[model samples]
Target chain A: MAKVATRVSYGEALVKYGVPNENVVVLDADLSKSTKTDTFKKVCPERFINMGIAEADMMCVAAGLATCGKIAFASTFAMFAAGRAFEQIRNSIGYPGLNVKIGATHAGISVGEDGASHQCLEDIALMRTIPGMVIINPADDREAQLAVKAAIEHQGPVYMRFGRLAVDDLYDDDYKFELGKGVMLRDGKDATIVATGLLVQEALKAAKILEDEGISARVINIHTIKPLDEEIITAAAKETGAIVTAEEHYIMGGLGSAVAEVVCKNAPCPVKIIGTEEFGQSGKPAELFEAYGLTAENIVKNVKEAIKLKK
Target chain B: MDAKRITELSIIANKVRKDALTGVYSAAAGHPGGSLSIADLLTYLYFEEMNIDPKNPTMEDRDRLVLSKGHTAPALYGVLAERGFFDPAEMKNLRKFGSFLQGHPVLGKIPGVDMSTGSLGQGVCVAGGMALAAKLDNKSYRVYSILGDGELEEGQVWEQAMFAPHYKLDNMTIFVDNNGLQIDGDITKVMNPTPIDKKFEAFGWHVIVIDAHNYNEIESAINEAKATKGKPTAVIMKSVKGKNVSFMENNPAWHGSAPNEEQYNQAISELDEIIKGLEAQL
Candidate 1:
């Protein structure tokens, strides 16, 4: 009778983790409130640094703090954090393999209203290409919390992608998330739908619709894009024979590219990728999703197409 | 430590310049102009000034040095090797495959190298970060970073300039090798970074302009930087692009180009005579 909400926004999860980890320091480049680092600032004013609008300087400062045994999380819009601070991350953090977490919010077309310039679609590709950088795109608030905690625990540089919009909370409070491990939400052998970030919920919904038609669909939430769970993905590909990947990013080097890399190397299976092929346009979140073909319906269509290729 | 000792260090810098030329000539490709320009400062820091032990390169309390203009690796490599951080014979492996002496400085590969820096403006920020870390940890270790004048064009350099003062990284000493020439041409024509002293002051740093090749001035600046409190110090060392080599001085072509055998011989002769003159004075 009522539409269900599945997850929390990335901002809420950041606050939950920041309150407990005293060693966790948050830095924002003048967008403290927008990036959700303001919550940490409220509780630990001394630990939070508003580094004006200098993202490059902020990244180096975070790397410095991390080198001194402090777990540092630098928060900024995806555009600034991934785009402006790329060199700093490459040399100072990635080169030395320092433990620094970059929380890049307002990723993809879901950043809506800000138009194309503000939204970042190629961040995952840029971050994942760097050696020793762990890329994580959490699906919702529960996963975002887990991702933040996991990033702190994981050594070396990590880039965590989150969205500006709030989504459904899929995980219960007691659920635990492991780095580089994919979670299978539904079990089926007919077709496999692998997805990440905000698209995981859509894949789950698509699985439900596929079941109504007497098709048993398997849905996996791939949170860790880099150091991908090859064993699990290869197993799923071998068992299902058909696979579809969806993400709120470009198909070139996002989750789809990662899945394709695994499938091409070890498990060759019929695969379909649903994501942005070109730059997103100025529109609402729903309009952008439909325009980019990142909807649950599109996932279902792509999954069926992949199933046809399997035969 | 004193005027006479600084003069002695200057003579040692000339020897370092000779070593740099030989190393680069052997490699057949390296930046010699900037390397010679920053030799005196590097020599004084490694030999006379900084409280460092080559045997314990990773000692937590030892002062840290970062060669931000890493293309001048020849100068740093020459000084570090001369200081016994590693075998002096290993200097021959510059830029060779699997050599610890990479085109740029890499940590752990070379002893006495505090950080790996090659991508221009990024190293200044890293050095600033290290200085900030020392302050946060309440360590007395200071950081010295040498940047090329041409690298001042990168915006990140200015970004670090704005941050260093806010945090009062007084223990950090930055040296700008104002060698006039970058890769293309003179820095003045390429990108004007005039009034450099005032710029550092504007960003809350204590500024000092000195003759870069002058051993006395360099040593004084180092002493002043260590004495000053509450703000980082930037020593704007006015230097010739190629200091000792007459034909290559102020020439941009020699920035990253190796000399012909004849030219290398000529450069060595001039350096050897200078070293002899200093020895005669002693």
Candidate 2:
């Protein structure tokens, strides 16, 4: 299978679908090349604004453009976009409910070599606290393109998370992407594996490993974490009775916390979460994933524990 | 501008000051000093300048203004009400629960507000974005913003100061209300953002200094800003902390404190006398 970074897909989609509408404008804080927003700038230089290494200014600028009927996409590293400029996003964009899309790339522990400062494990938590912010963590290349399209089509504030590392393509061309809806990949009766971002492929691999051990594990990809698909999560909990969640973020407030909130409210099930609990270190991407326990093996181990807890 | 027009604007400005004091007195907790400082400027923009319609506040090609120093929203609200953007009666409901007159300027709630702004340093950048939007769309409408002197302490303001000129946002003009006082004390005593004109000039803006209360100087500076090309203009207006109202003028205590009943009455009466004198001039 071909592997592509979600940031690459997002950049391609912005040029193909976003700028063609003429109302869509792109803003980057001098990280255009890394965030892949340079692709949009290459094609539409007039509509692209290089805000020059100021995250707070870029977010506010995007908010200002939104007020004037422009769909502005502000791109930067997740650490800066969500962590550094959190208040600007909350006050200027979220409070007013403006049509500003935050393209936060290089999220999570996958941002190896640069270590803890560059890897943003708290972006989901920071953005989730805002009143009307819609958070989408795409799983693969196809889903990333679709998430960008959905964000541009949506009428309010949207935060789209992308990855620095490439992962295998999990979906084909015919897949449909909808806001606030989860996609069920493989269904089973024993347990459910809920995942998001780069960990969705890990969840699928974990499901395969569990099946080899005679454990029928269901798989679900929850892209939207804010308006979480409680209906689907609740149904999965009721049918499977056990749930394991995987993500490339902190266990405290990422996909794990979101799924736990839904499961605890609607259906009482034993849910095990596979995510980092500490800051990541500088290493290879694979080594960082292993060190943080964000791998298919960890998801498989958690699934067994959840199944035992259910019994 | 002629004497008659200046007198008419002076009358309107006096009314705006009264309305701003009304909201502050009603709230019992709002920025009165800064609000009073910007009353004349607001009156001039909403009445004599900007091509805006009260009936259609969101009309395309309308010039937009962002109150970067948004704690002074009472003045903006008062000027908008005087311009017939909404009922003047709403001034009393400022900062009350469920009222459209919030403590700071909100965009959709108020008819004439171009952007929601309360956070210092953010509004100026947003105004730059609006100016960039006008250039991208090839529209003739210009963008305007007002900032407090102490607000220059915020680093985001410098970021925008660098941004507006780099992009050559010639369609934007910003006013720095150099009242010289902040919540702590005099701006120089607190944290010197002095040499403000020099800083803007260094940042590549067309810098112009004028007396904020002088209508002739204000109008001329605005004309200079519009005529200048290729760079944004910064009009540094030297002003009194509290322009009118005898006791509040240059008083740091009134920076964010509302007046008591007696103080409120005194302020309103002083403004009323000014309004009467301006009306007689007409």
Candidate 3:
């Protein structure tokens, strides 16, 4: 199957899900082409608002529309939406618990040659501090479609992060989307690789490599970071005795931090967080992922190291 | 236009000033300068302009108000209390523990507040959203928002300045309280966005200038906004930092201050005299 960017999938899903849902209104801050919200604009021009280059105003406007019972979605790059408009999201949308969905694309180091200026590594950290914010990071086109639909169905504020890179679909049309449930892709007992966003595919590949080496690894796709599936993560820790978390985000406060917070309390297990350690340099997505140690090779290496800590 | 109604609104505006001071004095903290500056504009909207019911503030077709300079919540809380959204007595619990009134305007906690606003440069843009929603839903309701002169420094204000006219939101009106003073001192010194009117014009807004304290002018400006059809309106009102109360008038230190017993007594007595004289005329 050919690969598709999650942002492109998101735009396609908006028209599919937004047509029947008449209350759906989309706002973009001068990045409709890049974020793929232009697809929504073409179909629903009356319901779409181009908020120009102002991300802060876009957030405030989204919050205001929500007050009037409109299911508002504001789209922008992660660096602008989650970073420039942090307080607007916190106070206007999250604090009020309004029905606003933030469609943030180009959210990680995979933004390629746009470099550290466009790459958003601290968005999860900034969004996590806001109260009542639901965080969703889709792993592939299939999950991205599910995440967009889920964000539309859920009531309160949701920040849905997508990527600049096109990824292969992991699930078929029958795959059900749940808000906080983790999907176990491949089962093993030696160790569990908890991954999110584009890193989920790498985890599955790492599991295959581990299988060839006579070692078993469990691969779990954790799309929602907040309201985490505590049951699945704890069970994985107890069953595998060691966990390795991977993401295309910063090492400090993305998926790794969220999983660590869950596993340490219920099941104390040795965990290795695989993520970008510093700002990204200008390069191709492949080179950047390799340089930042966010590859299947690294995940396989970490899985071996984690199995050693299974003691 | 009519002297009788002007007298009545004048009395109400003075009372609003006292109500705001009372809330601030009770809380021992708040932004009183900008609150006092925008009181008359707020009073005119609640009393004579807006299509709202204090009894049923959440009416679907009701007009919306967003105070973007949220530190001045004392003014909004005062106007809301006088408009019968809540008991005037509850406002004295202003910033006290367990009070429904937050330091800034919160939508659900208070009866009449349409949008939650505290950060500068956000409320006006939100007001644009409310107006756009009214257009989208094909409702006849309108939106009104007030911004402080000092708040013009925030970049988001210009963003919305570009937004409203591009969408051609004729149902919305923006009022900039050009009070000349900020906490640090004069607005020109802090960060001169002095060409406020020209900026709006360049951004495609129908611009109007008025004396904020003039009841007739305030009413006319809003009417003109309603009449203008293709774009949003921006009303820039020349105002004093602190409008009433002799000692606080034109003073920057009183931007957010509580009056002690003697000062409070003096301020109340002076406002009481003005209210009584206006009542006599009525």
lDDT digits (tens) for residues A147-241 of candidate 2: 99999899999999999999899998999999999999999899999999888888898899989999999999999998999999999999999
True-contact fraction per candidate equals 0.38, 0.73, 0.76
Off by over 4 Å in 1: A1-23, A67-69
Whole-model lDDT per candidate:
0.84, 0.93, 0.91
Model 1: lDDT of residue B29: 90
Query: What tier of docking accuracy does candidate 3 attain?
Result: high
- Candidate 3, residue B46: how far the Cα is off, in Å: 0.8
Itemize residue pairs with steric clashes in candidate 3. none
Model 1 docking grade: medium
- Maximum-DockQ candidate: 2
Q: Candidate 2: TM-score?
A: 0.99
Listed in order, the DockQ scores are: 0.50, 0.81, 0.80
Better of 2 and 3 by TM-score: 2
Residue A16 of model 1 has an lDDT of 73
Worst 10 residues of 1 chain B by lDDT: B1-10
Predictions ranked by TM-score, top down? 2, 3, 1
TM of each candidate vs. truth: 0.95, 0.99, 0.98
Candidate 2: segments with Cα more than 4 A from true spot: none
